[model samples]
Target: MTGKTALVTGGSRGIGRAISLRLARDGVRVAVHYGRDDQAAKQTVADIEALGGEAFAIKADLEEADSADRLWQAFDAEASGLDILVNNAAIIAPGPFAEQTQEQLARLFAVNVQAPFLLVQQGLSRLREGGRIINISSGVTRIAWPNDVAYSMTKGALNTMTLALAKELGPRGITVNSVAPGIIETDMNPWLADPVAADAAAAYSVFGRVGRPADVADVVAFVASEDARWMTGQYVDATGGSQL
Candidate 1:
């Protein structure tokens, strides 16, 4: 991936941060996108630079209607084109279907579904042939999560998008795939700090441990690499054998 450029949405923290650092280590110029955390974004960039890798921070609220355009505009200002696009920004609102508000549903879909769809649509013009598109989906789509019904549905849609786009973009040699992780130990799930809760979550994985951000990041790095050139339209199970 030397000299290649990658744009990692939500790359300022959690799984995103790990991915940014890992890809940078692979010699890819990373554009770390953050929604509201400027400090965290800057820190990620600094870390990459400290390792003799190239990286920059780009900020755009994914909840906005025109977020894709704004983000691309900002990215294009620095880089002339793109080779990898990782849609990793998402939100999870836990609530039963009956208790989920219309506003909550809208916001969830806007950020998780619409933003990625639109970003890919706009990115097609900038993404070169043989480019890669990696969508960060959740394993909840495979297992039932009634409390996270809305979030699960969004990931399901993303997975479907990955399948459809992989075929549509096959002629161009651009692969589109989704990486689904289960119970990753990230800031997004602070509840894992509890030993009991963490232990229960770890039981889901055959490895008997809660997955770290680097675990998912490593899978993503492979999917984005030339090693996966012939692999597309697939859902990578980065959940450490969860529910298998």
Candidate 2:
């Protein structure tokens, strides 16, 4: 990955941050994208640089079409074509569907689904032949997580994109797939901070401990690397058996 350039969204914190560092550590130059959290984003770039890796942070609220357009434009102008795209920007709402407003559902889809697709569409032209596209999905898409219907629905759409785009881009020598992570120790999982939710999550996984951001990032990094070139249009579960 020494000459490769990766674009990662929501790379300010949690799994997004983890993925950015992992790719950079492997010698890939990274363009880290964040909606806000400029400090966190820069900190990621700093960490990469500290490790002798090259990285730059880009801010874009990917939920908007215009923001998406500007993001790719800036990327095209600055970077030497894309080699990997880690579509990791997503939001979650753990409450019941009855409590989920239409706004919440739409917002989830916009970030988790539409944003990735638009980025992929833009990247199709930018990505080099045989490039990688890794989308970060949730293990909840496979398990029956009560009251997470809206979030799961958004991820389900991502799964479809993985399958469809893999086939669509196969002719072009690009591999498109998704990495579905289970409950992880990220701020996104407020449940991890709760004793009850934390205990339940630990018990749910085959591994005694709940997952960490690095756990998911590790798999994403591999999928994006040349080692996983033969794999595409598949849902790779890095969930510590949480789907079981």
Candidate 3:
């Protein structure tokens, strides 16, 4: 992956941050895309630099309608072409199916599904031949999550997108796939801080522990590498065998 260029959306924090560092460590010049926190973005870039890696921070509000176009435009200014595109930015609305509002549903789909779809659409020209496109999906798409139906639905769409794109882009050698992670230790799951709740979550995994960001990041790293060139349109589970 040395000398290759990759963009990781939501790369400023959590699982995305881990993926950014891991890719940088593998000699990929990273464009760390963040939605809001510039400080976090800058820090991620600095950390990569400290590791003797090349990285830069870019911003794109995924909620906005034109964000995808703006994001690719920003990427255009940074590098000549892209070897990898990781659509890791996503937002979730956790609530009962009956309680989900139209507004919340729209935004959830906008950020989680539509944004990635449009990003790929706008990025196809910049995406190099034989490049990789990895969508960060979730295990919720497979498991039942009645309380967060909208969130699960969005990821389901992402998984479908991966399948369709893989077939469409195969002629160009651009592999498209999705990485679905289970319960992970990140800001998104703060209840894990509670010992009882943590144990409950841990029990879902045969590994008997909540997953770390690095765990999922490592799977993504492999998927992004040439080692996974033969793999595409598949949901690479980084779920620690959770909810099995």
Candidate 4:
């Protein structure tokens, strides 16, 4: 991946941050995309540079309709072509089915589903023929999570999109897949700060431990590598055998 280029959305923090760093270490020049958090984005780029890797930060709010265009425009200005596209930026609207507002439902889908779909659609031209497309999905798509019904739905849609895209782009040798993680310890899951909540969350996994950002990042690295060239249109579970 020394001469390759990759883009990781939401690359400033949490799991996205780890993915950005890992990819950079693997010799890929990373375009770290962040919606907000200018400082975090800068820090990620600095970290990558410190490791003798090349990286640059780009900002675009995925919730907005024109995010895809804006992101690609910025990317094109920095690099000539892309070898990997990681759709890791997403928002979760946590609530019961009845408690979800119309606006919440719409925004959730817009950011989590629409943004990824549009990104891939607009990025196809720039993405090389044998490039990789990885969607950061969630284990909720296969498990029951009533507390965040709508968030789960968004991931389900993402999974379907991955399957369809893998088939559609197969002729061009572009492998598309979804990686589903469970109970990851990130800012998005603040409840993990509580010892009791953390233990309960850990119990969901056979490993009996909370999933780390690096854990997911490592799986993503494999998927983005030439070693995974034959795998496509599959849901690669990074869930630690959760709910098994």
Candidate 5:
């Protein structure tokens, strides 16, 4: 991956941040995309540079209507080709089905589903053969999560897209896959700060511990590598055997 270029959406924080750093360490030129946290994104780039890796930050709000186009436009200005794309940007607004508003539903779909679809569509022209498209899905799609019904539904759609696109792009030697993680400890889940709540969340996994961003990032790194060329259209359970 030394000369290859990769883009990681939402690379400013959480699992996205971990992915950006890990890939850079593997010798890939990383384009770290962030929606609003420019400072965090720069820090990620700096961290990569400090380790003798190459990285730059790109900003585009995935929730915006023209985000995909704008993101590619910015990316094209810096790099002419791409080898890997990690769609890790998503919003999770948890609530009962009935409590979800029309606006909330639309936002959820736009960010979690539409953005990734559009990004891939736009990137096809630049993505080299044997490229990788990895979607960061959630384990909520496999297990029941009524509180996050809308968010989970979007991931289900992403999984379907991953399968279909893997077949569509197979002849081109590109791979598309979804990685689903469960009960990850991130700022998004503030309740984890409570010891009791944290333990309850950890119990969901057979590992008896909360998943870390690196856990998912490491799995993603493998999917992006040449070693995974034979694997595609699959849902990798990065959930530590959750709900088993």
Candidate 6:
């Protein structure tokens, strides 16, 4: 990733952090974004530097109405042209179907759908002609996971957005794709390490293992690479065989 610049949303932790570091390690100059986790964001940058990579930390609550402007404003003065965009910031508010609320749905869609759409829109002008756009979607959309209707809906929208963006951006030589992970062991999913989620994650993969942050990042980096030039407007199931 030498000479490439990457902006990763929610890069303070979880799969986002992994993706940021992976790109940094691959020689990309990474801008790590965190909504509120300042310390974690700084730590991610530090870890990248320690590994001989270049990185910086930035923040923007991408769920708010003004988030798009806030994010690009920060990027405009601090970085050069962007070579990659990793739309990984998301909210996975858990609730039973009966307990779902309109407020929650609104909030989820704001972050998961609107945020990435605007990020890509604003970043498009500065993104290199053959730049990469990777949306961190979810397997829940395909599985129609119960109780998390809103989360699934946002992901479904993102998946569709990926296709539409791919078609629109393809002529410019830009590639857009979504990587949907089944279940990775991250603090974001407090239940992910539990026996039940563990069993569920393992069951989804024919590889007989649960997903990892790196596993998803590996595919993400690949999709972001020049090698994936021919692959666009597609949703890659990095979820192993979870949705199969």
Best by lDDT: 1
| 10 residues in a row with least lDDT, candidate 6 | 192-201
* Residue-wise C-alpha lDDT for candidate 5, range 1-244, written one tens digit per residue: 7898999999979999999999999999999999998789989999999999999899999989999999999999999999999999999899888899999999999999999999999999999999999999999989999998999999999999999999999999999999998989888899899999999999999989999999999999999999999999999999999999
TM-score of 2: 0.97
Per-residue CA lDDT of model 2 for 134-157, tens digit only, reads 988888889987789999988889
- Which of the two, 3 or 5, has more lDDT? 5
Name model 6 segments beyond 4 Å from true.
none
- 62 in model 2: Cα distance from truth in Å? 1.9
What are the Cα lDDT values of the candidates?
0.96, 0.89, 0.94, 0.95, 0.95, 0.89
Candidate 2 local distance difference test against the native:
0.89
Sliding window of 10 residues with minimal summed lDDT for model 2? 188-197
Residue-wise C-alpha lDDT for candidate 1, range 1-244, written one tens digit per residue: 9999999999999999999999999999999999999999999999999999999899999999989999999999999999999999999889778999999999999999999999999999999999999999999989888889999999999999999999999999999999999999899999999999999999999999999999999999999999999999999989999989
TM-score of each: 0.99, 0.97, 0.99, 0.99, 0.99, 0.96
Per-residue lDDT of candidate 3, residues 135-179 (tens digit): 999999888979889999999999999999999999999999999
Off by over 4 Å in 2: none
Clashing pairs in 6: none
Residue 227 CA displacement from its true place in model 2, Å: 1.2
**Which 10 residues in a row give candidate 5 its minimum summed lDDT?**
182-191
> Over the stretch 6-92, how does candidate 4's per-residue lDDT look in tens digits?
999999999999999999999999999999899999999999999999999999999888999999999999999999999999898
Which lDDT tens digits does candidate 6 get at residues 1-244?
6889999999989999999989988899999999998899989999999999999888899778999898888888889799899999999888898898889888999999999998888889899998999999998877878878889999999999999999999999999999999888788877765787678768878887788899998999899888899999989998888756
Deviation from native of the Cα of residue 211 in model 3, angstroms: 0.3
Q: Report the error of model 3 at residue 184, Å.
A: 0.5
What TM-score, to 2 decimals, does candidate 6 have?
Answer: 0.96
